[model samples]
Target: MPFGGEPPQLLKQRLLYQGRRFSFESSRLRLPNEQEGEWECIRHPGGALAVPVTPEGKLILLRQYRFTVQGRLLEFPAGTVEPSEGPEETIKREIEEETGYRAHRWRKLGEYFMAPGYSDEIIYAYLAEDLELLENPPGQDIDEDIETTLMTVEEVDRAIHSGDLADAKSISAFMLARPFLK
Candidate 1:
């Protein structure tokens, strides 16, 4: 009955964390063969990323230290989508918050799972054009230390090929955007 039985089905779910921003839960389920199991899953608010294009046709990138990766990474402007907010609204807010730039037009590039194996977090990628710099710098989180870098599309391409840019989201977004380049 190892592989022949049907998969598990959720029977009951209990809220674990119900904060002002997010909520967490634990699910109890019954397998096809009558076995019971429990799984913990978070109902994330989702997120968005912005591949911002400068007025000079350059891409705006950010270099920051990712604790989970134990190293610094070069990535596009991105942030978590607030509860009850649309993807476009999230991207616009994230771009402004991370890079201090306001995008006039936004094109949705694609959506992907951050880590499909473990979490159900979905991230929507976007291409932002017609940008304007904010008079004030972005107000980063207290623990966040990010440096913004403006690079030409060619520079980003070279970095990807040279192993300088290693973040998955950045690489994927850049690849998706390659077709639009001249």
Candidate 2:
């Protein structure tokens, strides 16, 4: 209702591209001023992320190479939500697959759009505790190249401040869960 009056009228929506993970669409709309305009957006199924903490109070993170960024980034374990999968289920599977660790306790941190202006990719964040390393955990995804690291809360804070951890979703997830972290 903040955009003046009623929602803008959608005139048309055309799929511009489609990919395994997401799709792009262009839309024709009539604005509140009754003027026509067009816009493009990326449609995604969204994702889930976890801030995993061990009993010893160390945080579990991933140093993963991201082709788009052209560098390895420190991030929480995360994955896109598959059809019929909730955020919790996605995060659980992702943590095990990515870190070889499973969690016995979990709490919801919060959720936010990764980039609301251009994409509809919401990421649900969780705080995972009571972790145990599996003797034979499921292997990581075929496409993933990752290395695991254990860091203290202080280290995470420093990394965030120093720009060592620059992934938006990971940073948002950690900050959301920080108040609940020990």
Candidate 3:
């Protein structure tokens, strides 16, 4: 047939790695069109990002070393949403925990599926304003070494133009928040 028959349907799923906070699952599916007849998939919980803006039109960003990417990257403060937590609440908590800043105003910017071809991770982006600095908590994740900085909108624009700020999440958030800029 031109449509190549119906796509595969999930048949079974089992957890591969179950951490204290998150779990990864392996799934089994049956494909009618494929001669092999069966396939496997990985399931993962998604993450969230907070694009914090200062009153002076600067964006609060984080610089950290990512082991997977094997480099330091500049990005907005972000984290995975804990179970039973809403996106706004997760963003608020993540911004404070990572950047030592609390936002008074929060606006839902947008959402995106990060690599829908392979993973089912959905990222929720938010715009935060009216920031106040606070003391950072100790015993943060050992692998997390983050430094916070504020960049003007013009600076961000320049980075995007020059191919400096190339992170997908950062680029998406900046584009989504462009209408709010002066």
lDDT of each: 0.83, 0.94, 0.78
For model 2, residues 9-113, the per-residue Cα lDDT tens digits are 999999999999999999999987999999999999999999999999999999999999998999999999999889899999999999999999999988899
TM-score of each: 0.79, 0.95, 0.81
Instruction: Record all residue pairs in model 1 with backbone atoms less than 3 Å apart, i.e. clashing.
Output: none
Answer with 1 or 3, whichever has the higher TM-score.
Answer: 3
Judged by lDDT against the true structure, how good is candidate 1? 0.83
lDDT: worst 10-residue window of model 1: 1-10
RMSD of each candidate relative to the true structure:
4.8, 2.0, 4.4
lDDT top scorer: 2
Candidate 2's clash total is 0
Candidate 1 per-residue C-alpha lDDT over 2-22 given as tens digits, one digit per residue, 9 for 90 to 100 = 246467898999998897645
What is candidate 2's TM-score against the reference?
0.95
Clashes of 3: 0
Q: What is the Cα-based lDDT of residue 41 in candidate 3?
A: 38
lDDT of 3 at 113: 78
